[model samples]
Target: MRTRPVLKATEPWEKLVWWPKVMYEEGRYRLWYEAVPPDHWDPEIGPKLAWPNPVFAGLLCYAESEDGFTWTKPELGIGSWDGSNETNISLGRETVGPMGLHGASPFMDPDAPPEARYKMFWYGDATPDVVKAARRERPDAIDPRTTDESHVRAMYVGTSPDGLNWIVQDKPAVVFSSDTLQVVEWDALRKQYVWYGRGWSWGRRTITRAETTDFSRWPLPQDVLTASPINPEQTDLYTNGKTRYPGDPTTHLMFPTLYDRATDQTTIGMATSVDGVAWNWTPGNPVLPVGSPEGVDAGSMFVGIGLVPLPGDRIGLPYAGYSYPHKFPANLADSGFSWCTWTRGRLAGVHAQTEGEFRTPPVRLAGSGLRVNCRVQSGGSLRVGVTDEEWSEIPGLGVSDCQPITGDQLDATVRWSGGSKLPVDRAVSLHFSLRTASVFGFEILDER
Candidate 1:
């Protein structure tokens, strides 16, 4: 399928909708996002500290839709700092940081028996006390000398019987100096509840993952993937790293790479994998290329958060829509929420569509033995000729100018290299090539 940008967020009032999740039980979709109020920041602290500004903190809001198209905001007003919502207030509203219950990934727990309940993994900041306590236990691991201020960032775990009231876990599931992003329920094959978060590396941004069988007793981290260039000493290769994946019955992560064309920034390339660890990136340039009417990702738009895998193998992307720096400015970033959807064609089977061959530098049919080499992807016909010109028009070869060699499935490629006797005239360059009429999500062979 050809990929396209899905949703574009372009207004502060509209920040209420994003990071969509499908509710299988009700056959609907839900977006659990943070609402940034107008004039919420205090200019005294500094421009960078505008968000987490304390005046207008994150209010975990919900929006729902039956068809995943149109949506309606439900006015529940259930969130409170004292944990007074009728739904189980697992986590306290009095967040350790300025914002509590920011960007969270919600899902119906598959590990829980049929009657257990739904779950949500919320990612936001922790209180300074909570941050210090966590760091004190790892004094050797935590360098207090580092004044990155991010040391206060921490992630808390939350849950709900219904989607409304919540229970904030007394202890957090994952905590790191930098801000955390999202989490998902690992599939049965993984046997763990995994959370994807972002943090600082020395002084730059990077993504990391940590998991556990039960929310508690969580392990530190095993490298899932790194964004650093092969040679970090060289400044040309680095990415503003982030990782997001689906957490439900099945699991997949969206791995993106930045293509900084400087003035003309490139589209964020993407890759998918069943497990979070071993990623199988798409081949060629990118799964999705740049040059579109969608909003530009200047200095802001920390978009590219999640995706909705459609029924017919299509994907609906939801992204932040605005023109950089101003899009997410300190106190007025709310004027940047708009959305768009991408629908793609899905290809199923593979069949040899067509094939042809030609010879260069004229050759004689009289004493020159012909050597034909071929490369095939998705398996296609190999056409060989005895002369510098195409000879499929001549008789007795048994194979047509184009013949079937392979079909559409996953990815199958084969190369043919053989020789035939021919009369000689002059040395000629054999033209062996591959052609396909079908487009596949994956490819198998390359000339080199």
Candidate 2:
């Protein structure tokens, strides 16, 4: 918790580097994000809410990276910003209304059609006359923020062959009130299209989830991951950075940016799920905290869409950092992207003050040995035992016979008297006992 990510990128014209989602495809990494202008204001007129600034309200730009660390933006000359086709824009403002497109989430579907291989889900602002008429008819009778009138702020889908060119669906697929980041990802493990976006509850931010076999139709959104029961009632969570846990399909890892409206500070916190619909919000710690009290990210720190495994046993997570309160000043380009890392499997762990034990659910062993991701302190150690169906420890595989394991290792193998001789066909359980250590995860090592 409270891990740090280094500043990764910035753009001269990108005043507010908004929601960024990254996808791995074409043998490289592609980052799709929204860019806003430096001068942010809430105009009295609804039409001018986005200020007609092409780069501010509706600029979607693309960037590429080789290692998920260093990034480069290619000038596509696709959009006419400030007069001519002279920006690194992906979706041109000429094709759509200003600030119409936001929160662009690119997804690579293996089971998708060839022509429409790459797809995106984003907010398309279309001020409908029905809602407008109702507001005019009875201004005092409605609260637009909570009313279905705001549903005109809809979510639309677009397909692209190369993540650049696109064909947007003519009509809004699912209409909902959206302002913050919305994510759409293909859950390969579950074979479903997962949609996580913003919904209002008690005038604060809340996350709602919906699943569909087809992107065109989604059922009513249900509240899933939000502020835990223990958190202060006013604390808000934005952009549940949900991703499939590496090496384990049964677990989903999420790092939601927890924002405290009182302090205006944002940090990434951990929440876990066995099924994407239900979540267990980690209490009292952040997977990554906001920047320093006087630092660039002091105000907000929203983790980006992708999580990459980097060299030297590190995990790369991109995040956008910005100062708090959103007041504009001379330095409007202070907000940008940052890449952070962690020791493998350190996102969540069971800590032992002096000694503790935990037994994992039964698992079939298809490999020769077992490996564990854990860290052992200098004055402490860890030992793991295998149990049978009856919860009985096998001879030479009991805690007393285990080799005392030490060190911070991502894949430290468990050794017994006879290596690679554990029973393979039966469902066995791993019982771990440790002293002053943190056990992250375990895996059955295949015989080479």
The global C-alpha lDDT for each of the candidates, from Candidate 1 onward, is 0.43, 0.71
| Top candidate by TM-score | 2
Q: Candidate 2, 290: how far from true, in Å? A: 2.2
Cα lDDT of model 1 by residue, 1-448, tens digit: 3223233333343332233334434566666555543323435532443344443344555666665556656556454432334321223244323344555656667566543356666555555566566666644333244354443544556566776666566665545443333555554676777766554454544455677788643545543544434313321211212333223433364534343434323333444566666654444323333323443433333333445555443445554433434213434322232232333322122223474433445443333333222224554444433223543323322233323334432333322233223334344333333355333222212222
Report backbone clashes per prediction: 39, 2
lDDT of 1 at 299: 35
Candidate that would win on lDDT: 2
lDDT of predicted model 1? 0.43
For each candidate in turn, the TM-score is: 0.60, 0.87
Per-residue alpha-carbon lDDT of candidate 2 for residues 61-131, written as tens digits (9 for 90 to 100): 88888876667888877765667666777785566555547767777777888888888887676456644
Can you tell me which runs of candidate 2 are displaced by over 4 Å?
Answer: 1-12, 38-56, 129-151, 247-249, 326-333
| Poorly placed runs, candidate 1 (over 4 Å) | 1-26, 42-57, 80-98, 113-116, 135-151, 178-180, 228-251, 257-266, 284-306, 309-313, 325-434, 439-448
